[model samples]
Target: MKLLLDFLPLVLFFGAYKMYGIYVGTAVLMAATVAQMAIIYAIDKKLTTMHKATLALILIFGGLTLFLQDERFIKWKPTVLYTAMAVALAVALWVYRKNFLKMMLGSQLALPDPVWNRLTAAWVLYCLFMAAINGYVAAFFSTDAWANFKLWGYVFPLAFIVGQGIYVARHLSDEAPAEKTE
Candidate 1:
């Protein structure tokens, strides 16, 4: 459900881009992101961090899109948003001497801080790398190509992240026996 909530706005953006021009598509995406956020709030009775962060970016970029009447601003939206998140994660890791991803995802998976740091670094790097990739596509590729990447390219890394979590869990389990004996 959470994944669907995240994906729907991008889907709508692509659909709107197909059905209309970039301006209309950005408009539709702004509305769709709000609608999705509303639905998520109703389901959870509160906004998740992802929802808040996503909403912030959408509002900022949407306003820029509307105010400037330039689709290029909105086109750069994802790149900026993703880059910001990556920076935040990196800054949090440096300041706290801890991985923020572990704090965020700790309820679901319990692992050592060192392992969390590695995961966090990987996630941060991935986010930054994707930001660069998005920027490249937006600058050089067609809008349709960028939209396809936005929608379809998401699945691969998500699967890889899950696989990484599983690998970390297995490694932790192996260390558990040794720790118990000591």
Candidate 2:
């Protein structure tokens, strides 16, 4: 359910682009993102910082795309978002000596500080990698090619998440109680 909600905006954007083109697709994406956030807020009663950042970036970039009639704005949105995330994570870890990922997920998952540090560093690198790839495609490719890449780009994140899950699983403590003897 949550996963569907998360993908709904991107799915709608791609479908709209296929039918109408970039401007219409941008509008659909903006609307769908708003609806997605509303539904998430209704269910969770609060939005995370990441959620708010995503919503803001979508609206701002989507609005610029529509208002300026430039596909570049929408195309560059992902690059900008990924770059910002990478910088934020890097700065939080290096300059502030704080791990933002650990701060957010620590309550749910208990891991050693070293593991958290490694995870945060991995996230920073992953974000920079994503930002660079998106920027490269958006700059050199045609709009149609960029749009297709945006849709197919799910593979990268899916792989990253699976790999992260595997790494984190190795560090998770076995909290289950031992079997009782007769």
In terms of TM-score, the best-performing candidate is: 2
- C-alpha TM-scores of all predictions: 0.85, 0.95
lDDT value, residue 176 of candidate 1: 26
lDDT of 2: 0.93
Q: What is the C-alpha lDDT profile of model 1 across 82-126, one tens digit per residue?
A: 898888889989886767777677656657777888777887888
Compared with the true structure, what per-residue lDDT tens digits does model 2 show for residues 1-182?
87788888999999999999999999999999999999999999999998999999999999999999999999999999999999999999999999998888887787889999999999999999999999999999999999999989999999999999999999998774234489
CA lDDT of every candidate: 0.80, 0.93
Q: Stretches of candidate 1 above 4 Å error?
A: 171-182
Worst 10 residues of 2 by lDDT: 172-181
